[model samples]
Target chain A: MTRLVVLSAGLGVPSSTTLLADRLAAAVVRRLGGEAEGRVEVERVELRRLAHPLADRLTTGFAGEELAAALEAVHGADALVAVTPVYAASYSGLFKTFVDVLDRDALEGTPVVVAATGGTPRHSMVLDHALRPLFAHLRAVVAPTGVFAATDDFGDAGLDDRVERAAGELVALLSGTATTRTRPTEDERLADPTPFEELLRRAGAGPTG
Target chain B: MQLGIFSVGDVTTDPTTGRTPTEHERIRAQVAIALKAEEIGLDVVALGQHHNPPFVASAPTTTLAWIGAQTRRILLSTATTLITTTDPVRIAEDYATLQHLTGGRVDLMMGRGNTGPVYPWFGKDIREGINLAVENYALLHRLWREDVVDWQGRFRTPLQGFTATPRPLDGVAPFVWHGSIRSPEIAEQAAYYGDGFFHNHIFWPPEHAAQMVRLYRERFEHYGHGRADQAYVGLGGQFFMRKDSQAAVREFRPYFDNAPVYGHGPSLEDFTSQTPLTVGSPQQVLERTLGFREHVGDYQRQLFLVDHAGLPLKTVLEQLDLLGEILPDLRAGFAEGRPAHVPDAPTHAALVAARADQEVPA
Candidate 1:
């Protein structure tokens, strides 16, 4: 089964950020129809509900139950659709904080579709400037096509077209049709126990035997 | 089971009084606390090392040696001695001298100091913390056991024909406990050497302590030390108590709300519920402490944080009195139905006897 997680950093009920996230999730599900065969699961995490907990995490260095559940969902998902309301020409503080709280390697190699909603089309650059770079730092495979919705694009067909294109890119990556970015396999140098003999040798002590 | 108190040696203002103890006063108070531990029949008095302001315990061996001179039965130890930055040769020499001064009543806990800048202060890097610990401890382990050692490691200068002065008393090295809050490699290190693994059980939830202890035990058996249940495990706890539970909470709330480490984060009530913090009567403290065995299984040592967050020495002594009242019950509760094969916390006398047994003809 394919699990898709939607992270919506929307501050208010019926927020446009959540609306964008829902549209992206729906588009991905629509594209997954034949291959997924009703085996796709969608989970939504509203950062608005986790504001206080996120603050607690910053202070205490641990996540509360609800936030932990959200992190677990994200960690286990096959792909992610993250949408945030652009604040001060970038992703909202709440969105960045949620990402910051995740384990350093939690999102490694996970496919992600980055989207954003902002006041002006000029802020559309946030998808590339802010969101894409953040996921790239986490080693996530970000889809090449990113969807940005300004206030005026909410009800327009243009928004739907962009969402479909981004969702198709994500679906193609997930379905093994598109070439995803490659990451170096995890280092195994530390995996095995350094033989006691080798450790003694490094310490300039001959092997006891 | 061995019962004791460990202090981070912070100098903070008493929140209720808004008065801070001087560095001199705080240092003296630590010695007094150690004396009090022996007087009250406690087993151990461990102090932490911090090289920054608001913390004055930069030299633990010096302080412990002073405490050792005044106290007879109390075991002196470092809550943790920094292994990553400090030269292992100095650690070997200083602790060995301390063991001699105290008549072998010494053991030391190894930890990678937490402050980021402490690394650079000692001309080391915090990025190589785990490797430094692994290498430094391996060298330290050999220095104490071997009369002469030739050693080279990444963190410090090489040693040739080096015999650490004042060899460990009776030729039995002071017991070592690797103290780690979140590192699995540390647990593995302790297991590899058949040493003790101590989890500071006060800050986080019980599950974290359980997980670390479980790993240490599994790896201990993997190294052919013993059964998993026989692995040496020590846990740390924190508590503040009064005759009445409500009064205890009322009295400790101000200190808990403004103190360092956890002050600004979770509320007192929330922190107590989430961690192994008992702020109530002596009976309640005993019950909560005894419950630790349920998660981590039968363990060897139980240390408490009794004097921190600017509690005045008088109040800390009173807390010790309350602890003295409950120590018997706590000890018995932990000892009940404990298996015979499980080892007690390693002590000077026990180590000496084990060495004697080995030297004897089979």
Candidate 2:
């Protein structure tokens, strides 16, 4: 079974970003099957709830219980659906702060579906221009099709088509059938007990008179 | 177990009084705190090294050497000597001189300074912090153990046929403790050299300290040092005490609310419950400190952060008196039912005597 985690960086109770996240999560479940009978298990984390704790973590350099639980959910998920509200032509500050708190190598090879909600269609390119590159920097395998929901797109059939396509891509990735090639697992990529002899050799080959 | 105090030597304004000590006053207060530790029968006094504003303990060896001249029994150690930027040869020479002057009352804790600007100021790149720690300490280790050393390593000029004067006190290097907050590589390094591991047990929860100590102990045994239980471990704690717990809280709350490092974050109650900071009576401090062995197992040293967060020198000295009141109970409680195979914290005289034993016949 695949565990899917949805991270919504929406600041309000009924935020459009969170609405998009719920739709994406439901689409993932529907692609698997019905809700109770689906092979995909879903968990949702609202970064809005973690704003104060994230700020505290920034100051103290350690996570509180709530932030730690959110981080654990992200780290342990088989695939992640991240939805954020667009602000200043980029992801919201809260979304970026949450991402900043994660371990550098935490998302090394995980599959991710990036989505965003904005007031205008002009900000639609944020999915590729900002969110895609951010996840790419983290080494996450972002889906080729990113979903952007404008104020009017929420009730339109085109939004449904985009969600379905992105969710299908995610399911394919989870089932090991996606065209998106997988990166090496962390254990396979990292050299355990990093060869000390190589380190010594590097030390010996230093600048000298 | 060795019990004492460690100071970061921060020069913050006392929130209760809105007054900050002059740098000279703060430095002299640290010396007075060390002297009071000895007078109160504490075992060790460690000072931290910081090279920035709001902190004054940039020269720990010089401060410790001055304290050594005034005191007789208290162990003078650094909360951490920066191993990443400081030249290893200077470390070898200066610490040997300190060991000789103190008659072996000196041991050092090595740590990578966290301040980024300090790294470049000392001609080091913070990116190579772990590599610098690994290579610098490797050379520092050889300099003390071998008199005529031929060494070459990254991060420093090569040395050939050079001796780090003084040759250590009685041909025995000062005991070393590797201090770390989160780095597993440091734990491995400490274990590989059979040195002590110290967790700055103040800012974080017990589970974090337990996890780090467990890794160190497991690796210590894996490196053929000894059984996991025999690995030397030290922990740092912070406390505020009065005759009454309520008075203690009322007196320390202002400092807790406005002090640096942890203030303005978790509430005082929440922070105390989560970390090792105990602000209460002598009995309460003793109970919480004794509970440490429950998570990390039997350990050798316990150091407290008694003189930080802008508490006045008189208030800190009073806190030391409270510690002296409970010192006997703490030692006895920690000693109760401790396994016989576990080793005590290494001391100058004890280490020298152990070396002497190794050289003599059965």
| Most lDDT-accurate candidate | 2
lDDT of 2: 0.88
Write candidate 1's Cα lDDT for B166-234 as tens digits: 888989899999999877778878988999999997888888789888888888898998999999999
> Residue B62's C-alpha lDDT in candidate 1?
89
Cα lDDT listed for each candidate: 0.87, 0.88
What stretches of model 1 exceed 4 Å from their correct place?
Answer: A34-38, A177-209
Model 2 Cα lDDT, one tens digit per residue, B1-362: 89989998899999998999999999999999999999999999999988899899988889999999999899989988999988999999999999989998999999999989999999998877877888888899999999899977768888889999989998889899999988777877888889999999799988888888888888888888899999999999999999999999999999998879988887889788878999999999999999999889999999999888899999999999999999999989988999999999889788888888888988
| Chain A TM-score relative to the true structure, per candidate | 0.84, 0.85
Give the DockQ of candidate 1.
0.26
What lDDT score is found at residue B362 in candidate 1?
81
Candidate 1's displacement at residue B148, Å, is: 1.2
Clashing pairs in 2: none
